[model samples]
Target chain A: MHPVAVVNANGASPIVFVCEHASNNIPNMYHELGLNAADKISHAAYDPGALGVLRCLVNEFDAVGVYGTVSRLIYDCNRPPEAASAMPAKSEKIIVPANANITPAERDARTNAVYVPFTNTLADIIAQKGGQGIVITIHSFTPTYFDEPRHVEIGVIHDDDPTLASACVTELQGDGSFVCEINEPYSREDGVAHTLNLHGTKNGLQNAMIEVRNDLIATPDDEMKMGIYLAQQLRKTFKSLGIDLNEVSA
Target chain B: MHPVAVVNANGASPIVFVCEHASNNIPNMYHELGLNAADKISHAAYDPGALGVLRCLVNEFDAVGVYGTVSRLIYDCNRPPEAASAMPAKSEKIIVPANANITPAERDARTNAVYVPFTNTLADIIAQKGGQGIVITIHSFTPTYFDEPRHVEIGVIHDDDPTLASACVTELQGDGSFVCEINEPYSREDGVAHTLNLHGTKNGLQNAMIEVRNDLIATPDDEMKMGIYLAQQLRKTFKSLGIDLNEVSA
Candidate 1:
């Protein structure tokens, strides 16, 4: 079974956006870490309104969006199962009660149920698109991790498809309102290429994971504004490069 | 965390044998579908007497054995997550009760917990051996599928690394007691190249999955005899090919 979300639109749009870490919902079986409803609704549970951006992008551009339903704290959809962060030991400095001291049986269950389907979904979506569409993943990162402050306004990550990501970086850089980095503030070599490595490089697809500071997309308004900005910028960049987004068929 | 089963040697031998489908036990959480205890103990749960053969191989060759703990029925450790049979819809004509109508959350759990860790365990073993050891996966297959009878007494499955599998097939064919089929009864394209594709092809290692008729290895005596026969034939084949199994070290 495929793990990705498909928008079955027969359009000529060249881009498909995937939000691997768009949600952070813990299973109902997994309690709220002894926290209140408001705490659960915080950035800890979901991506703090990243789905709004995805929704806007789908409506504005002829594209599909694929995402994971479970929290990355359970099993990171963006990471390979072998990666340490795939099933992180901790999240937001709060100990994940269920993840502590996982047994072999427990580990097997998570892999079979979550990680496999998530990647399979992305692969199937790409296959269904006939391998011609470009892939752009939308994500939000915290302003800081532990005590380390992050500097870049936006980070574009790509493994084999640096062309599009580079163009995006250049476009955002030239814009006075934002500061953009290509494979920086964070980069792919740091093991962020897990999803792209398996789904993109393995299958020779053009893909990138774009990270926006969570603070920039913390509300519905912010998500919609950024979504429109990104869609316009990406479309302009692709157009300038003589690549026609409309040339892609469903 | 890696999932590994290691059997160390108490004697002076420098070889190690690996079995991919050594165990097939579904978790207690996934109750057996109307099957009795004896049915669970049958080939459906584990390779039919693979442990006995693997034990005999270790003794005859004086080596170590590393295997997976859970059954492939849960998630075939040998398959890539994208493969259809990685998590089969049915097992031995019996529907997997827990696997039916699996949600996205359930899919991620299985792939993250079971499939990834199992492959990681195998990877760690190969890395520790420093790429100097022979990797062989022992498996048993039914005499027939549906109503179609299989004629070959033995089959070797290989993906790109036809060197080892091909050699073994030649040696078994030379033995009058067995009819050997190279890359058959099933081909690598037949969805059995899980371990081979990831561990061998992706990592550039020499490996082969050996399929002995289930009936041939069902009994202890028969298992021991086949193990000895396979070990001797493999030794001869390696010698003829000038491949040194002992050269693999940490």
Candidate 2:
């Protein structure tokens, strides 16, 4: 099976969308990574409705979308290969038996299979956009984590580059509807911004990771609504930064 | 002792210089990290003549310079703490007995003592620049690594952002006086672009890491010459990019 799926690969817009935790299909080789039926479809497996939201954004703006197709428990595409969390032995309370004490060869095989292809696909699409590319990653967080509740409805996350995140937060506040925050739910310190840091900020592109509460994007309608709202905020952000989406490079 | 040294701290120039592997002092705390007199002074301990070149660039451009004052063998400021090479058990063929199988507490202590302070200082200075900063890290690499010979004299290295690197290389080629290459000797894959990726490109700043062969900058006179030559190349590069160094940020 393919590690990643590309949607709107030839989209005309200058924006690029990424959804790393988009699927929960653990291949037959790892045998569901020794997960029980309940834990197999849990938020630990993948971000609940991130791919749906990403699809909405891609269709709304005619943007390219690159999403991972395997469960993050197998090999987290968001993390670099060197990080232990990339192939976690345990996530939250769930122990991943297949990942525990895995040999270097197995680790390398998983990384090569899952992460390399996902990275290369996203990188190629973004490079095609040249300097005009604006990267926006889609993610969904559980409303509660480890029995603790989270108040943030929309997390406009950024690493060292705060241009897009700051703009999105300002616009959200101006709209005065959503509980938006900058770097909420997770931040660069939590290792959540690896995808943004590698693909967005490192490339000198205006970028942000928009993470919605999983409960907020639980259904198809909700995902579309959230995506549309984010699109408006991003449109305002680009205007503030003097970027025209329709400007064709000579 | 201070973990890092700042020269021209109040300089008004838009550029900021970083020299992470500047010193070979292992401090009295860990007993020179268990190295002999000759090994302590070798390239494995720190980058030889990097600080000299950095200082020359700072003086020439009236730019701020932040450099590590302790041996990279103690803690390489260029590397993130999670990286094993940050406190390497070995460098090249030389085994560092002190770094092998170190306790997490000892590793954290060294990170706090060396890497943390160095990182904070550079981050703070760059923040003060208000998006006008151009980060340039300087280093002098050994002419030979292991048993292999390296012919590249100067490496204009960059990570995902290649704007400044490409400009600098083009300008250097036009000058036709130096052996320059883009990401030769060491690339982002070699983990040499960590500092640039963290502080420079991530901040939406034009950044590049200039690597001079240690043989070319072995003396005070050689260091100044190389720095001046690099300064000229950077000036042309910035001009080509339509950045005026004299323009004060509003």
Candidate 3:
């Protein structure tokens, strides 16, 4: 399968949506990367319901979406491939046997085959939108990780540029549907801001990554509602910011 | 005018060179961006001698080089657009009148006109190289800043991926020509690693930025010698790493 699936590649909207942990389908060749049935479906593999929400967001915003096609068990697309976490030997408390004892050459192979394609595709999408593109990455976290519960529902993540994320948090705060925080759940130091740094801030694109609590999007219907709500709030934010989405190309 | 100048864009080499602070030319339209002639040639405007060294690298390795056309004083190509440092109001105690009290729209305009094109062009070059692309950024720094003196002559900077920078440091040791350090002069936090983070590690490329003391490249002949030495050192490093520069399209 292709490393990434870009929805609405030719769409007119200037905004680009990214779902880095969108899939959990391990290839048959790797034999589920030595994981039990339950662990395979766990958050350690991928964000449970982010793809569904991202799809709804695409439809709502008429935007371009870049979605990873493989499970993080094979390769975490959000990570810099040279990092050991990119092909983690263990995530959370579970050991990934297939990731153990890998050679540098093998690691490079996975990066070339998977991570490179994903990056190249996303880069192309950003290039098409010119400099005025807005990047909105979608991600999710479990309500309880290892035993600790997270209460924040929306996390607006940023690196050096807080302007866009600040705008997002301001608009999200008044909605009152959920608790919102700047750099909560994960910050740039957590390595969660890698994608935004590469695609959004690097090119000076108005960018933000929204992290939703997995429990808040447990069901398909719930995910859809969250997506619609987010899209509307973002629309209002853009309108308030005076961004003409059609004027992205410079 | 084009925001970026690509030298040997399709050269059959794995490495792509970038000189982000190559120029000190502020377009005539902005009226030199409200800077005096002295400030225009100051370290705050551009990195002295970086372009000359970059040219030698491109020539020696037959590699692709992407050079920024405008001054960093206008819109720092290496910085994230939303970061205030990208359009600094002051650098090393020198005030930039044009950068001070600018509206968001004006800031965005400069980013759109200069930063976007440079980013898009580099992305296209990286895309063409597929997964085997290696990024090498060239820069120069002042001998003294804020009443402090620097003894190091060379700085090999990296973000997350240390493979390439480590290789260069190992090769440069005992060269008898310069003092070298990894992550010196500037690091990721200094915002100096912006290009490496965005274009290199983010895409899983073997990458590093080399910073030389400006005094070392004060003359045309000195620049040429420094450039030749750098090219030879880099060539030796690549050979030691078993990197086939022509085989970059993985």
Give Cα-based local distance difference scores for all models: 0.69, 0.85, 0.83
Worst 10 residues of 2 chain B by lDDT: B216-225
Q: What docking grade applies to model 3?
A: incorrect
Worst 10 residues of 1 chain B by lDDT: B7-16
* Tens-place lDDT digits, model 3, residues A1-250: 6779887677778889999887666767779888997677678888866876897798777888999878777888888887888999998788989899888988998898789999999999999886778888999987877889888888889878888788888999988779999898989888888789888888988888899998776543456568988998888788788887767533
Residue A36 in candidate 2 has what lDDT?
A: 93
TM-score per prediction, in order, is 0.47, 0.50, 0.50
lDDT of 1 by residue, B40-65 (tens): 55565557657657866876776777
TM of chain B, each: 0.88, 0.97, 0.96
Candidate 2 residue lDDT tens string, A201-237: 8898878888899887654335656788788888888
Q: What ranking emerges by TM-score with the best candidate at the front?
A: 2, 3, 1
Q: Which parts of model 3 are misplaced by more than 4 Å?
A: B1-250
Model 1, docking class: incorrect
DockQ, per-model, please? 0.01, 0.01, 0.01
Local accuracy of candidate 1 as per-residue lDDT tens digits, A105-196: 76767777788888877777778777786777777777887778878878888887688788878888877467788886567877777777
lDDT of 1 at A238: 80
Ranking by lDDT: 2, 3, 1
